[model samples]
Target chain A: MELVRIQKQDFSVTEEIELVKAVSKSIGGVVVFLGTGRDISKSEEIVRLDFEHYPGMAEKKLQEIRVRALDNFNIIEMGIVHRIGKIEIGENIVLIVAAAQHRNDAFMACEWAIAELKRITPIWKKEITKKGEVWVEEHP
Target chain B: MVKIRFFAMLKNKVGQEEVKLDVPENISLEKFKQILKKEFPAITEFLDKKSIMISVNQEFATKNTMIKDGDEVALLPPFSGG
Candidate 1:
C-alpha cells in the first residue's frame, strides 16, 4: 500500500507495515523511521511542541518526496505520515516505512526520505518551554 | 489580486495567516515583496533575511519570478521539520 498523509492523530506502526506488506509478497526487508518529540533542547526543558504546516503544499511536497524516493532507490513501496497540531513530549512526530527486496535498499531509502522531509517539507515547530515559546528556525 | 500566505513565526509576527494585495499584473516577486513590506511594517526585517523563501503556485520561486492575478504566494521561513 502507498500512503502519503498529514494527520493529527497518532498512528500504529504495525498497522502501517501490514498495509505495506499487502502490496507485495516479494518484499524481503522493511525499514521504519519514527521521529518523536523530545523533552530537552539546548539545556532547556520542552513542555510541548506545536507543529504547523502549509495546508495544501505540505502534502504535495511529501508526495513529491515519496515519488522521488521510489524512482531513485530500488524500493518496492513506501509510506509516509506526519503529525501536526499540538504534540506532547515523547509523542510521535513523523513516520516513514520503506519496503524493498533487500535490506540495503530499505535502509538507504528510509534515511534519504527523512532527510528530504526535513529539508523541503513546509512544516515548522514551535517549542514551548518553561520560560516561553520559541519558534525553531534552524534545521538540525 | 494575489494571495500571500504566512506560516510559523512569520504568521505570529504578522498577526495573520494570509492577505490579498491588489498588485499590478505581471509584477516580479521582488517588487511584490516591496509592496508587502510597506503594507505589513512588522515583517520588514524577516522579509530581508536570506533564509526566508518565497513560493509561487506552491513551488519554490526566486525573486525574478513573475506574479500575476490569482496566484497563490507563500512567504516561508526556514523549514524546521522532521
Candidate 2:
C-alpha cells in the first residue's frame, strides 16, 4: 500500500497495523505513533486547532520522509497519515506505523520518521484559544 | 511566470492563497522578496518579523538561491504540525 496519506478523517491505530501486517505474515513487530490535539497551549485553554497544509507540497515532503525511513532502517513497511483542517481538543491529529521483523527496527524507524515529518513537512497549526488566535511556531 | 503560495497565518495575513507573477530570469531569492514586499504590502510586516520561510519548487530555499520563471515559491509561517 502507498504509505503517505494526508486527509481530514481521523485514523485508527489498530486498523493501520492490520493494513501493514496483512501485507506480510512474516512481520513480527509493529510500532505505531499517534498524535492528538490537546486542550491547553502555553497555559491558555484552546478550543480547537486549525491545521493548514500545502496540499501538493506537503504530500511530496511526506513521501520523501517515508522513502528515507525505509532506506535508513530495517523496517519492512511504514505508514504515515496526518489530519488536516480544524480539529477540536482531543481529536486525532496524526498517525504513523512501522512494521519490521524485530521490535528495534520498528521502534527506531517510527521515531525517526515522526521526528523528520515534524521538522520538514509544510504543515502549520493555528490555535483558537479564549484569548483569540495564535499561530503556533516551529521549534526547529 | 512563477507562482508564489502562502499558507497558515501568512495566508490569512496576505488575504489570498497564491499569486503568479511574470518574474525576470535569474533573480535572487532576496531580490524576489523585495518585489513581494512592494506588491503585497501586507507581507511586509511579516518579513520584518522573520516569521516566514520560503521554498523554491517545494524545497526549502536560501536567500542566495536564484529564482526564475515557472518555479513554485511558497511563503510559509513557522510550522506547528505534529
Candidate 3:
C-alpha cells in the first residue's frame, strides 16, 4: 500500500524523493508536484494564507483518496503530503509524488491525485490580502 | 440517537460543532433537517438556501436517504481547499 500523510510540518524535496525511492525497487519514472502559496488573488497582493481543517475528517478523507488512486492506477508507489496552519507567500502547500515502472502511469497518476485532492479534501484556505483576509470558495 | 457534525463555515454559523438528537425512527434526511432547524433556530437561515453537503457514516449522502440510529451525519459546505 502507499503511504499518505496530511500534516502541518515542513517538507523538503530531498526527503520526498527518498520516500518515493523507499517504496519502489525498479521505478523508471517519478513525478512530483509541489503547490506553493501565491502572492496575488483577484488582482490583490496576498500577504499570507491561513489553512484550517476538521482534524480527524481531513485525514480520513485523504486516506480515502489515496486508496482510490492505488486502485485505479498501476503505479508502484505514491506519497502525498499537505501542510496546514499559517503559511507565507511562496511557501509550500502540498506535495505529491507518484512512481511507476513506466513514465506514463507516473505522470498521469500524479496529475489525477492532486486534482482529486483539491476537489474532495475538506481543508479550507483563507488568503490574507492588503485590505483583509478572505476565505476562498470552491471553484465550480 | 444520531450524532450530527458540522464543519468550516457551517460550524461558525451554527456556533457548535456537534449535536446529538434522538430523531424519529425511520426518519428521512429531509425530515431530520427540518427537525434540526426547529431545534437550532439559529441554523434556519443557513439551511434555507445553502447547498449543504451531507455525509452519512463518513460518506456523502443525499437528502432523501434514510438515517438510522447511531449514524454519524456531517454537514459540510462546498470544499474550498487545494
Tens digits of per-residue lDDT for model 3, A9-49: 77886788788878768888899989899998778999998
Question: Where in model 1 is the C-alpha error above 4 Å?
Answer: none
Location of the lowest summed lDDT over 10 successive residues in candidate 1 chain A: A1-10
Sort the predicted structures by DockQ, highest score first.
Answer: 1, 2, 3
State candidate 1's DockQ: 0.90
**Candidate 3: what lDDT?**
0.81
Separate DockQ for every predicted complex: 0.90, 0.76, 0.61
Best by lDDT: 1
**lDDT of every model, 2 decimals:** 0.93, 0.87, 0.81
True interface contacts retained by model 1: 0.88
What RMSD, rounded to one decimal, does every model reach?
1.1, 1.8, 2.4
Q: What is the full ranking by lDDT, best candidate first?
A: 1, 2, 3
DockQ-wise, the better of 1 and 2 is 1
Which scores better on lDDT, 1 or 2? Answer: 1
Q: Could you tell me how far off, in angstroms, the CA of residue B75 lies in candidate 2 after the best superposition?
A: 0.6
RMSD of 3: 2.4
